[model samples]
Target: MTYLKSAYKNAGIHHKMILLIIVLMLVNFAVFAVILKYIFHIYDNQMYKKTSEVLNISSIGIENELRNIEKTTFKVTTDEQLQRYLLQLESETSPYTKMVLRKKITNRLIAFAGSETYVYSMVVIDKEGQVMSAGNREGIPQELHSTLSELADEYDGSNAWYAAGHSSLVAARQFKSFTDSNFTLNGLGTLAIRVRIDRIVADRVQTSGRDGQLTITDGKRMIYPETPLLSESDMQAELARKQPYGIATYSGGTFFAAQVKSSYTGWTYLHMTSFDDMFRHITIIKEIVSTIFVIMLLIALALGTRLSGSITKPIVQLIQNMRKIEKGDLDRLEEEALGPVPFSTQDEVGLLHRTYKKMIRRIRELINENVAKQLLLRETELKALQAQINPHFLYNTLESVNWLAKANKQDRISEMVEALAFLLRSAVSFEEQLIPLRKELDIVRSYVTIQKTRFDERLIFQLDVPEELMDAQIPKLTLQPLVENAIHYALEPQIEPCRISIVARVREGSLFLRVEDDGPGIAEGFLEKLHSGQVTTRGQGIGLANIQERLHLIFGAPWGMELHSESGTGTSIHVCIPYVKGDQGHVQGAVG
Candidate 1:
């Protein structure tokens, strides 16, 4: 099975199409053959039924005729003249009187036989084998007289019909004295009626001029029309199979035969006909159908070759062009190789060819654009390298200003410049995003020093962070933003003294830090504006929103800042972050 599948897969479209057509044709032929066989079976059953019907009709007619013969036999045997004459013939020994009695009995037999057209002869035999006859010149065979008498005696006064010869039927009965009712069954002599059975069958049975022949069996022997297709014993064996009415092959399997047994006579009637003759037309039809199928198959093969060739030709050309492209000949794709037509149409093959051409053009354009972009990127990198010394220049300039303030005996100016330089360095540096809380506090203290010089003594700054949490890791410059917002929003707006406090501790495995201010608290909705980044910071630093974003970015969720501020009261901002020791081991489920 695997080999067949592999072979089919490797076969070209043309051969595969031919094979497919042939397979389909064979399958159709099989279905047609089955249907034809079923039709033949139906026709066969119809034939059997029709033959059985005809046989049944003929049997009925023959039975009626035999019944008439039986009635005639009964009338003759019970006749007072015939019965009395036969009894007297048994006792009388005078030749003249005996001859007279024989003549009278013969006349009576002739009278009885003349009433039926098919009765050939009628004869009576006494116990001593004296024969009296009528209706035919040839009488009963002398050799058959005793046999006929014995058969008649076995009937015991009832009519017993049997086939006499190839062409005749004999009904034999024993006659008794009708004068005494008690002696009615007593046997006196045998009376036999020889009937022309051929004449009776000829008038009664019709085969409609078909080749069908009839065979009658008396359960033991063939009875009529001497040339039987089967012997008596063979026919009896066939009948003994006991299918009363059905069709089957018989007569050495030469003919299809239907048989029906008569209920009245117990004889089986068969109608046999040659099988070839019976199914000749059906055979011819089958032959014609088979021939047509084969012719159609040949025509389909011729058509399939042309069809597969048309479909596969374009596909093969496209594959050839793709192979050229695979070999790096991007410009070698010819319009003719794409499809039969240079321009596209609505069909899928046409669409595929057009799309391939478009893709090739796009590839060339992108190659040129990518080269130009690469040149521009190299030039920009050189300029960026030239500008790398700017940060050091700014730091050196601030250090020079700080020393000049100290030399001028300007203490406040020197302190502010030193703090500004430190803040500048911390903001500009990008070495590590996470720093120890103690380092972040140093940066915050530097920012507060600069703000405190600006606010004088009105800014009351307090630091309440614990010593143990100083080693905890937090994002660099995180606390400076919140503390600056408090000074700008809480203290800078009022002339009176306002206090700002930075409180830090560990709670539920997280560092919770709050920057509280006691100035005129943030105005209504200003805290919202501040958190949404709508309110710009007055100081040169990242706002509270930026710090919240930075904390969230580093520690994921539940680790941002929350603001609590009300009008005429202090504003407090809570900053929550995951607790990590200075070595950077993280605490899980810590942020709240």
Candidate 2:
């Protein structure tokens, strides 16, 4: 075992994988074979149970049918009217009286035979040569006297049943004198009822699944079927076994044989099912499964070889690249043969190759990073100086304009100047990305005031923010862009007055600020174009998409802008943010 382990450890990965796969397939196939055997065992058990139940039920049915036949024979033999008529017919010598007596007995026999579907015929024989019969047969049966003699001697006064032919049976009972009860034992005549055994077997005997032959015996000979499928001696021998039911062998063929003995008639009902016939499909399935297992083993071997090679080839290439790097041949690593496409297989080997390449590039980038950093610092300083100068100059100019308008008694001009100053300050401030709700709304109100002066009654702006939530912190410029979008898409297109409302509410630990307009809604597919930055705006202003990105950067997921609108149903934009009270400190790094 130690030597084998050492050999396996020394083997290449491809060969190792192939060996492991073969071993696994062998183990799996062994388990499958065991499971198949267990399944077959269960199937055999089920078949046995079903066959036993059918045999028992069939035997009971046949027994009941035979009992009914016995009752009919008993009723006919002890019938007082029939007994008196038979005796009178035996002693009377007048032709007309004899004919009348025989007719009456024949009518009684016909009635008895008609009452049972399985009964074929009925006959009565007095002590003399006279015969009275009914149904199917017009005259007496062959050797009726001898048959009755045998039955009378064997059964005494009880009913006796014996096979009449291949498909029929005869039941015999001694008709006795009913006038004198003490002399009832004296045989006045013989009454025989012929039964259709085929009908009885058809109605009562049931075969289970598959092909099987049914044979019944009177503990003497085969009766129902004209001929036996098995040799008579073999069947009798199987019946003679101590076991009531089991598998037996006859003439080198296997059979499942079960027998039930009738309690009333003492007949044996044997069902012999050929083993080959019952399990022919099972045998075919075994062959098919074995063939499939062999085929799968072959396929697995082939696939294992290919898969092992595929897994190791990428690793081999990576190792070769490492060897080149060891020899200081880094230039050759970037050639067409070692390009990114060659190592882009989306596996660990590919990732390692890519990481190695990135490390090489990072080393070169670090060598020049110091110089690039110095230049970037100078450029940023110059831009910051310009940003400070321009915003300060703009605010100072707006203040001067407000003073000039107030001196001229131009109230509208002063109001527009103040609103413009406020809007400019809010847009230029880069110190905080989040501000109080009241401050953001103040900026929005200033912007709306300026727009209201321009549109007058055509722009009906309504604000419904609750006073309690005015101090909640939110992302700056959140509502300004949404209000601007409503004006552009909702108000500017129509001549009628558009009612634009901003409503704020607190829900589920968050604050929702909705901006709605009672104007024609934006067209379908326009929102998608807007989000994709395809819908170009007229001036230098932030779009709704910018607000969405800001919210995502500050609050991560699920807190962002949602828009709902339909044609002629107006438009509403909801800005969702976490409701944080008081100063939450300045959010860092996202102001720009």
Candidate 3:
């Protein structure tokens, strides 16, 4: 139970988990806001678009109705009986005949007016400013009479003439008489039809509450609804100019208004609908979305708090364990006590725990093994170093005796002893693995000095070394062995003086040392076998092989020794190494 609790505590909430929740919430909110805003805008625009379409349709219907009324009035004005009565009145001289014609004309006009619902009244006026036939004079304003008289003067006795108003529409036609082939005139008379504009408006306004209010206006006055509308001066100013169907607001409410201009008579029609009714559905949807968002937020908060704690506890415990490891408390690490701390998931943290446990086991094993190997290797190197001293001591003792005899003028015997001493010194002192180019030169000089004494001018030696490369390091006794081999093969059996040359110089940032002997050059197969590590000569010893190995180890295979020879020309052994002057210790112990 305690282990379980510790694991839970360690697995604390990840910051990424919290951040993920925040991002999700914000994204959801943003998406909801976008959808809501778009839906509301689409709904509002569609409502206005649909309203405009309806108003346009209504204007067309009203225009058609007015047109039908004009057709009916035109038929009545051109009737055969009315035309004949007017023609008879033109020739009537008797007062009794004149009265009869007048009565016929008046009756005809009265019958036509009563037959149509849209025609409020009809009237005939004579050329002498005398009214002949009239209907429903009660509804006709007195001020309109003079306006009618002016309209009559402009009429050229056509089939029909019409005028439109905010509340009504009117049509007028002039009457003329025809007698035989000549036209005879009694009086110029006018026939007029009056239309009820309110009835046409009533047909177009819908009764649905969501359809909003409808209003009609002329430039100067409100006609339909017949009440004051859009009382706000600012709103009124905006509506005063004619505009096609679009959204606008007034003192009472916001609305969409459409205007139609009549082609038959130059009158403007306005249709207005309130904005409040158009967007009512959108308000309901917004309220629903807001409520849902609140409820979802409450649910998310409740669930997130609990889940975050569950995830965070185990992570916290893991962090504490890591801190203990950092403090070097490896023994205190509760490996078994860590017990399978349930990450409870197959993700990266679980993999990390498994990997860490395996790494700890491997690390402990490596640490113990490394410690043991270090001690053993140190003891073995010490033994190898101790084994190098006995040969060097014996060679030094022999050299001391040779120098003593040379001081006593015992020259021939001293020379032989000196040669043996130098050979022994070169063969020993293997522990001093690297020596300077100058030191190698000194060893070679000592060997050559003894050789010259023994041979008595039969062997000639030349040494050419650059001053700059004198201190460059090489393997100890590297050049001495090569020089000995050259002397043995080239001069020991020669009849006259044999020329031996040693040259040391720096070439292309590497040291080049060459030993050339002017004697019958090596056997063709012998040089190949020497470089291939195949021993060829009966007693060649390991001199050349050892030098090649040391060169290979110090400077790698490419920078090692190369032998060039021709049977009669002589043999030259060349050694190449990177010039490193101050790296004596590294040169002495470096492995090929």
Give Cα distance to truth, residue 130, candidate 3, Å: 15
Off by over 4 Å in 2: 1-22, 93-100, 137-145, 181-184, 208-211, 242-244, 249-254, 274-277, 280-288, 311-592
Better of 1 and 2 by TM-score: 1
Candidate 3 Cα misplacement greater than 4 A, ranges? 1-57, 67-110, 117-198, 202-209, 212-214, 226-235, 241-243, 263-266, 276-324, 332-362, 377-434, 444-473, 483-511, 515-558, 564-572, 577-592
**Pairing residues by index, what is the TM-score of model 2?**
0.49
TM of each candidate vs. truth: 0.70, 0.49, 0.58
What is the TM-score of candidate 1? 0.70
Tens digits of per-residue lDDT, candidate 1, 1-592, equal: 9999999999987788889999998999899899989988898788778878888898888889999989998999989888788878877999899999999999999898878887888989987788988886445677778888998888788888777566557889999876663355567789988877777888998973466678887866567767777766667666776665544555466666778878878887887776778778988998999899989999988888787776677667778877777787745444433435556355776777777778877777887788898888888898767756787888899889988998999999998888989988888788987888898888988888998887889988899988988998888877788788888888877899988888998867778888899878887677778879887666665777787788778887667889888888989988888788876554433332
Q: Put the candidates in TM-score order, highest first.
A: 1, 3, 2
Winner by TM-score between candidate 3 and candidate 1: 1
